[model samples]
Target: MWAVASLLPARRMLASAPRGDGRPVMLLPGLVNSDRSLFLMRRYLRRLGYDAVGWGLGRNLGARAIGGEGERLLARVARLHEESGQTVTLVGVSLGGIMARFVAHRLPEAVREVITISSPYAGDPRATRVWRMFERLTGERIDAEGVVARRVEIARPLPVPATAIWSRSDGLVNGLICRDPEEDGCRAIEVRSGHLGVQIRPAVLRTVADILAVPGQGPLGTFRP
Candidate 1:
C-alpha cells in the first residue's frame, strides 16, 4: 500500500527535494530483500543530485550475505570512499540499517553518516514481528549469547552523525526500539508510516535529503515533521 501510494506524489516530491553535493550514498535493502527493493529510492536520490547506489552484495542475509564479520561490507565502503574521495553516507532499510550501523562502527573513517529506516537496533530482537523469519533466514537464534551481545554493541552511540526514521504505526517492529533516545549524536525523526512504506514515502525521502544536506559539523536534532 505504501509503495502504491508513493507513486502519484513521487515525482512531485523528488522535484522539490533538497539537492545533494554529489556525495556517494549507498542504499542497503532489508532482510529477505535485495537492492531491487530500493530502485525507486535510488532513482529519487539520484534525481535529487546525489550519487546513490545499492549495497551491491545481492540480498541481505545478515553476516552470511555480507561475509564473516562484515569484511566484505567493509571492503565495499572502503572502495567507495577511495573512489569518491569522500566519506560515504549509508542509508539502510530495516535489517540493512542494522548492518549499516555495524559497518559504520567498523569503518568510521570511511563513513560520513548513517540513516536507518525503521531499523530496530535499540531493543530486543523479539520485539519485531519478523524475528522468527529472521532466524529462519539467517540461521541464528536471536536469544543466543553472541546475538544478544552484538545487539548491545550496535545499540550504543555511533561515532559519527546518525539519523533514525521510524514510525509508531509500524506493524513489523516495535517503533520504540528503532532509535536510541540516549544518543545525543543520533537524530530521531518520527513519521506516520508502516514499516515497509517508510522507505518509499515521499515525506521520508525529503527528510532524508534535508538531513543529508546539512553540513557535517552542523547539529542534528529531533525532527517531528
Candidate 2:
C-alpha cells in the first residue's frame, strides 16, 4: 500500500500565505510540458502574494541541447537573481526538476532552493516508452554515460536542499527514487495524485505554498502525517 496518510482528499499545507512584495520564483515544468503547464501554480502563488514565473523556454520533453539549453536557463536565472536581488527558488516538475538540479549546480549563486515534483534525478533507465522516440529523433540522449552519471551524482547528497514530492500512483517515474539517500538537507513527501495532475492538485498547491513560505526549509516543509 502507498504510504499516503489519506487518499480521499489530498492534504494542503500552508505555513502561511506569502505576503506580496513580488518575490521572484521560477517554475520549471515537467517533460513534454510548456510554461503554461505551471499556469495553475503560478496563479495560486500570485494569490498567495508571490511573483512566481515560468521557465519561458519552449517544449521541455527533455534536455535537447544540454549545453545550449543549460546556458539559456542559467542566464535567465541570473537575470532573475539580479532583477530581484533575491535568491530565486527553483521549483521543477519531472524533467524540469532534473534540469533545475543542473542549473543549481552550475549557478548556486543564483538559486535559493530546489523543489522537484515526481522528478527522477537518478536517471530512470526504465523510460522505454514511445515518447523516448522523440529523444532519438531530437538526438537527446539521457542514457549517455556522462549524462546518466551526472544525474546520479546530483541526485544523491543533492548539491542543495532538495525536496521531492512523489506518489506511488505516479504512472511515470518510480516514487522510490524520490526519496533522498541522505536525509540531512533533503526530504521526501508522499502525495495522492496522478502523475500529470500533480501540478494542478490543490494539495500540491498548499504544499508548495507552505514550502515556499519558509526561506530555506528545503522539501516537505508542508509536512503532514
Candidate 3:
C-alpha cells in the first residue's frame, strides 16, 4: 500500500535529486500524515545540496497505545548515521516535533540539530474553550499537563541545537505554545502562518533552506531575518 503511495513523491523528488549529497536531512511530517505529505519539502531539500529522507513512518498520531515509536525514530537516525559520517538533522512539523525530540533524547549521538514547525511544545490543550471542541472533534488526546511536564523534562540542556519554528497565526494548536528558552541549545523563532501551512508557507520554506545552508551548523542555525 505504501509502496504505491510513495510513487508520487518519488517521481516528484526525482526531478530534483542531482544536487542531493552533502548533508543528510530528514523531514518528519505532522499528525496523521505520511511521508507523502512531506514530499515537496523533501524534494526541495534534496535539490538544496542535502540528502533528504522522509520519516516514512506512516503517520504521527500522538503517542498513545503504541509503544516504542521512539525507538523506531532512533533506529532511523542510526541508519542515516551509518550511511553518512555525520549526524542527521531533523525537521519536524507539529506532533512530529515531539517525536523528533524523543528521538534526539535517545540518540543524541545521531542527531546534529532539531527544528520544529508549529508544535505545541509548551502545551495548550485548554488554552481556549474552542480548543476543547477542536480536540473532541479531532480526537486529539492532549493531556496538556502531562505533555508540558514531559516536554520540560526533555528540554533541560537539550542534547542538540534546537529551534522551535512557530507562528502567531496558527489556529489549530495555540500559537502561544511557542516558547523561548535560555538554554544555549534551544531557540524559538516566530513566523507568520497558519498551522496547516507551516510546512508549505513560502517564508517557512525560505527559512528552512537558509537554515540548511549554514556550515558547521545543524538544521537550527543563528536566527536570520
Candidate 4:
C-alpha cells in the first residue's frame, strides 16, 4: 500500500488540499504507536500548508497516558494550543483517535476539529481484536469504572467539528464502531483500506486533505473509493 501510494503522488493531484490558512493540527498516534508512526501523515498536512504537529508525548500508553485532565496528553495539548494561538485540529489514528475525542470533549475551546481514523469509540470494546492487548497495556479492563465512564464520555458529541474515518476492510476494529453518532455536526467517511493502510493510502490522504480544507461542519466533500 505504501509503495503504491508513493507512486501516485496523490498530493500533487489534490488541488483542493491547500488550506492556505495554516491551521494548527495535532496528530495522536494509535496504541503502542509514537510520533514516528505518523511522520508521513503529518508531513503531508504540512506540505498542504497546515501547521501539523505530533502529540510529542511518546508512545501512546492507552488510558493511563490520557485518562485524566492532569495527564501528559492533556498537558501537551494545552501547551500546543497556548503556543499556537489557534484552535487545533486534533487528528488521531486508531487508539490515538479515541484519545483525541477525549481531548476534544474536555477542551473544545482549544480544538477546532477532531478527526479519528479507524477508531472504535462508539461500540463494544470487545468487538475490537486488540481489546485484550489494550487491557494489558493500560491495565484498565473494559468494565472498569474509569474505562467505562471514558467510553461514554468519548461517545458523546464534541462541541467542535468531528469526522470519523472508517474502512470496511479494517481488520483491527469493527468499522461499524467508527460511525459518527446521529448528530448534525458529525459525519463519517468510508475508505477502501485496511486499518493501518488508512494512514498512508493515497486516497485516504486525499480525503483527509479535502476534509481539512473545508471550513465548517463536515462530510464537507466526498472522494471516490
* Winning candidate number (TM-score): 1
- Stronger candidate by TM-score (2 vs 4): 4
Off by over 4 Å in 1: 215-224
Q: 65-176, model 3: which lDDT tens digit per residue?
A: 1232455667777898888988898988886776777778878899988888876666544643344553553354456666556566655556887878887778877766
Give the top-scoring candidate (lDDT): 1
Q: How do these models rank on TM-score, best leading?
A: 1, 4, 2, 3
TM-score of structure candidate 4: 0.91
Q: Which pairs of residues have clashing backbones in candidate 4?
A: none
**Where does candidate 1 have its weakest 10-residue lDDT segment?**
215-224
Against the true structure, candidate 3 reaches a TM-score of: 0.75
lDDT tens string, model 2, 96-170?
777887888888887888888877665464642333654664466767777666666666565566677777677
Off by over 4 Å in 2: 1-21, 65-69, 127-134, 218-225
Error of 3 at 196 (Å): 1.0
Q: Name the better of 2 and 3 by TM-score.
A: 2
Residue-wise lDDT of candidate 4 within 1-225, one digit each (tens)? 563546366646654565647889999999898899888888888878889999887788875666554377888888888999988888899998988889888888889898888999989999889999998987779898877888899999878888888887788889889875575677788887788657777777777787787844545333355
In order, what lDDT does every prediction score? 0.86, 0.70, 0.67, 0.81
The model with the greater lDDT, 2 or 3, is 2
TM-score of each: 0.94, 0.82, 0.75, 0.91
TM-score of model 1 vs. true structure: 0.94
Candidate 2 weakest ten by summed lDDT: 1-10
